[model samples]
Target: MPSSHLRAAFVLLLLLLSGCEQEAQAPLDQQLYIWQRQWRPAHAEALADSRADFSTLRVLAAQAHPGAGWSRIQVDRELLAADGRPLVAVVRLDGQLPDLDLQRTRADILALVDHWRVQGIVMQGLEIDHDCASARLLGYRDFLRDLRRALPADLRLSITALPAWLDSPVLADLLRQVDASVLQVHAVSAPENGLFDPARAQAWAKRWNDASDRPFLLALPAYGIALVNGRVESESPLAIAGPRRELQADPQQLAELLANLRRDRPEHLTGVIWFRLPLPGDRRAWRLSTLQAVARGEPLHADIRPDIQQSGPLHEFALANLGNLDGPLPERIELPARSCDAADALAGYRLERAADRLVFTRLNEGRLAAGQQRALGWARCEHLDQGGSRVYP
Candidate 1:
């Protein structure tokens, strides 16, 4: 038998080897898409994941603003051809309808659509949103009619219905012209912030299901919301600085939410599409681990805080900034075991304040965003403030 010291050294070596193997086996969070400008790196890494199944992977090429025209757009012909066929492209017609001359925009959009069609790509849908007014509705309807005439029979058309538009009597008639419709239940407009009500989202989805024969895709916000010094704005490279606090739901919570949504209304549900894939080197508020977990059929856990006054079936949570602004500031925070609830578990990070410097613990070191909300999977903070160190559970 080996001596005690020798046995101990052998055990240590074995543990170290095991750790190295785990590090090697850990999945690289490299999923990418061009929607958020993270196509190349993700493609490179995904090609390396031999265990990953890409059969169900659907590529979407979305054009959010057609009024700006398609001149500035760079279409990647190589990426567009996965196995030598065109990918599904969703063209978004956003902004005030008045700013859009439907006839001209339609012509522009149709030109691009035809170009892609000839390349053998599937133009899955034309996503549009308009205010609920008699003239606007009629004008939009007319545009759809012309667009439909222009599209090949196999091409699909879809529209986004604001909550108010869904309430309108014309919704049923309007949906008849399209193949699919997406209900943008969550409101992101200024003055009305973080208005994501899961119950309300479900209700709106149900209404669409009962009213229209068209299939629908429910758009959910993959990132959480935070008030950057009490200001809520759209996230972009040039927009307002990063979020003041991160408020993302955990992956398990997201899984539960999806599972619940599937259980409550499976017929209306098609599939979940995370808003804009995370950009390469983006350390902001996105849970890549959670996304991977969901994709791989793993259980996800979330830290949710409940709203007492809400009577809806869905649960809600909020993440807030805990440190003071005037002083040196608490550079880290540790959330104790009972800090979260069943619905809104702490799944991500909130960039609550804009600081010149910020540091993260082992799990979050390379993942935390300096000026944005970041969703957490298995990470925490250390050496916060001038006080004690805090660890996020």
Candidate 2:
């Protein structure tokens, strides 16, 4: 697309966005995506708080295709805090709209809602996250209208909307059917393209904020998709390999995006919600501190610490980085080795006879970012026991 066309489209979006900052701002919250058949809380200290409005729970995905089965998300009662925060039950619809049995899907959702309602859980809202194709916008709109009418009047009805829906003729009709909608502007990307396009996201937020008097929330990704650069198959340094790991969200990026959103947010903007809440050890997740930094729009620096433990006949160590910035996995570290330390005491460290310090040179090239930690090399320990402390100067 030409720059001029992009600019023109942006201007058009500005014209499309409705009402000035209106009343009734919604509280910001994080999503809890439970793909696990069962779940347990890993970090209660970080997760249990008023900061979260509601934990959007995925009740299940209704597979309305010819011979499909239900994929449910069941959580253990002990896993969550009953601190009065509601659960926004979300029913995801799978398969193509053309192939889907909308009636069956609607019936499945109602069953789920009633199931929850009878349980007496504190649930004030029910949302659907469906990426219905653009051509199926009308069908999606119709399905929502039916679903809204069928649902109890008290429960808030919302849908996770795709950017494609914004330009569709059915956008207004779709809005009229639901109590609210969330514009998910963050899409997976090539590293160069990034997980989010702030300009594009801001434009869409404005567009939706203006298009609907109904409540609107601009959803941003609090996670990252790691796209590794360079490949063995392609010699080019810039060649990106398809191999990827789910990169945890960077606190810096989140802070930056929140800052930008504040500037571009329209009058009708309710609040922002993260893609999902992250649990400890989740490969594709943000550190709890990272999420906190994002919520606060602040930069956090990294602090590195080393812990040593006795392993078999040798000593083992772990390096931890707790700061926000990636740094200080220093180029050279000196371990105060005891004279009783074996000659081969620290295998990876270069020993200085006169200095008596275990010198870590090559390992210093390592960079440890905040909220991450890893194993550090260890070696023979003579008379010393495990959990021994050595000072680093």
Candidate 3:
């Protein structure tokens, strides 16, 4: 083809691509926000501070369900303190509603709402994260819809959602009926168990944002690493074991993650909720410095530190052997650390044979503040014929 004709065709193709991109983007009028679980105790305090700059907040309620805790609602009258100020109240809906009276439950939630209103309190919203197959999902949706219809028109509603459900054909229908003040997309996938992928998380967010006009919030993990027999096991909260490693996330990686969210689906990008508040004994997770950066919507550019700490000879040897485990052991060993900072502040230590396996415990005095230290424990394992050891607790 002639040069002029080829150039004209290229220009036309570029224009067509640009038009398609514009059409695919969601409208800018949509609002964005975050839904924090009650697990983060400082949630209300955090919101009260400058960190609460987001457009909305979704509070998880407490409750018990059938079979196991599917998701139930608990109403607290003290949601607003006696002085008439907002107090962070959470109602858990983990298990199925007990065989209790339905009327009582409804009345309870209404009473809690009334109490909050009288104190001039503004609720964030509600959060529920059960499997889609559970009857709890349907019941919860109906309950929310009914509650929304009955409550003041200004009140907001929100819920926790898994990626799998976001992709379901029924999700659009289900969401349409609920009074969704915000939809929090939780990335609690068991990736090692082949249940979730991080990419799927991004896709799920885009899918929901594409399907509905409701605002969306993304929940990021705030736990530490779990090592066994020399291999990094999993990042799931349930699988975590051993002393928490101080893994500082690189600012750059975080920036990339946030950038991907913005590029793939900007409209749904309401805000982010760091999975947890500050906890003690979690050395191998993102630090407050990193979280503050995320809260600011600034670009992240730091590297994630490995979970194991290397201070002295014994500790270094113990860490090396722990990372090279071959099989499971009989008894689980516990190496206790006083606090998160205490674990980080260690200068050096060494590991030696403790019966069948080796053990190295850091002896430090410094400790994290009261609300910081959750707990810590470690296990010991025996080596296999191939000269490798394994430990699981």
Candidate 4:
């Protein structure tokens, strides 16, 4: 063939390739993880809201290697029947064994899959949550390869990954065997430091994307952990991930992250999954509205107010936040009561008595969010100066 003809053919091919474009994906979808033992009311409500693309449930028991032998976690059959919604099964294994019992492990995993299949639960995919150490990634890879081969060809397999794994060559080798992963960028705790660092998470996401070609979903922390003062307690290490800190994600911060991830989203990037969908009683975790607001990248403003209503000798007091943001108990709140005589305290409230006023330093494990009105204790005051009360954030 002539050189000119060859060049013309190559040019035509290039033009055809350029003309065909990858379809644009919709604004990244949202996924929710239900990691609790009992199905909380929040799960039902969130699903009813139709917010999440799919809800992943933890089915299999946690995996471990105790006494240098393989151990399997008992499956949580709480979610026995699928609610006819798109459901995914999660198998969580948290153990450090010098050597894995690959054959037995594979069998156990396959059995778990079969159990779910036998039941009415229709799974769209399987997600394995294992925090394997960096040194053991090769073995992990082998396990994954065997697991993939064992699973049905139709069921996609995914796993939870650490940000540090992004740089490891074994991660590249491992992801080849799985369908997708959830990059959890929360709970990297340090003393006197925040649990979820947005900047670090964003950087890690970028690196993870560049490190591999696998489709991945970003796992952001929607819950907060309390930091135990390890320094004072010599027995514990510095900054342990707590005894339940009400430190949850702020919607504004979450909104920022959602927008950032969407902007930096690669073609293989799947969607965003909250570390959890919390129950209504979780004062430290985000509510469904906050999650929705974050997904929409909207700013959350709060206007919390304390009101007192009087009916003769009896008084009705309420602490409420009329704004969108979920406001927790501020550092302190002061009431007009000057000692117990002028304004006798009621029994229902947990308020402290200061030098001249009744102060409130905290709530009874509750947050001041929109639509959440707490009925504060009533005092016997007919003409109390409302101006004497104040609140500080």
lDDT accuracy of residue 286 in candidate 3: 42
- How many clashing pairs does model 3 include? 48
- Tell me the tens digit of each residue's lDDT in model 2 across 176-238: 999888788776334455567766777777788778888877667766555454322211233
Per-model C-alpha RMSD: 18.0, 11.1, 12.9, 7.4
> What's the C-alpha lDDT at position 36 in model 1?
43
Q: Which runs of model 1 end up more than 4 angstroms from their true locations?
A: 1-34, 37-72, 83-86, 97-99, 118-135, 188-192, 225-253, 295-297, 301-393
- Candidate 2 similarity to native, TM-score: 0.73
Query: For candidate 4, which ten residues in a row score worst on lDDT?
Result: 229-238
Clashes of each: 30, 8, 48, 1
Q: Across residues 1-393, which tens digit of lDDT does each residue of candidate 4 receive?
A: 999999999999988776653334356867777666455445556555633444444333335445634344443334334345456677666645556678877787788678777764577888888888878899899999989998999998999899878667788889898988888888654535666788888888888888788899888877655445433221123454545333455567777887876656666777878767666676556666666667676677767777778776665677777776777655556776543443433333456655566666653444677546766666664345577888877
Model 1: per-residue lDDT, tens digit, 325-388?
1011123443322112122224333332223212222323223322223332222222113223
Where model 3 places Cα greater than 4 Å from the true spot, the runs are 1-61, 65-90, 95-104, 118-120, 124-137, 179-187, 194-197, 225-253, 266-269, 279-285, 297-393
- Using lDDT as the measure, which candidate wins? 4
- Candidate 1 vs candidate 4: which has greater TM-score? 4
The candidate, 1 or 4, that scores higher on lDDT is 4
Evaluated against the true structure, the overall lDDT of model 2 is: 0.62
Using all chains and alpha carbons, the TM-scores for the candidates as numbered come to 0.59, 0.73, 0.51, 0.74
User: Looking at candidate 3, what is the lDDT of residue 105?
Assistant: 57
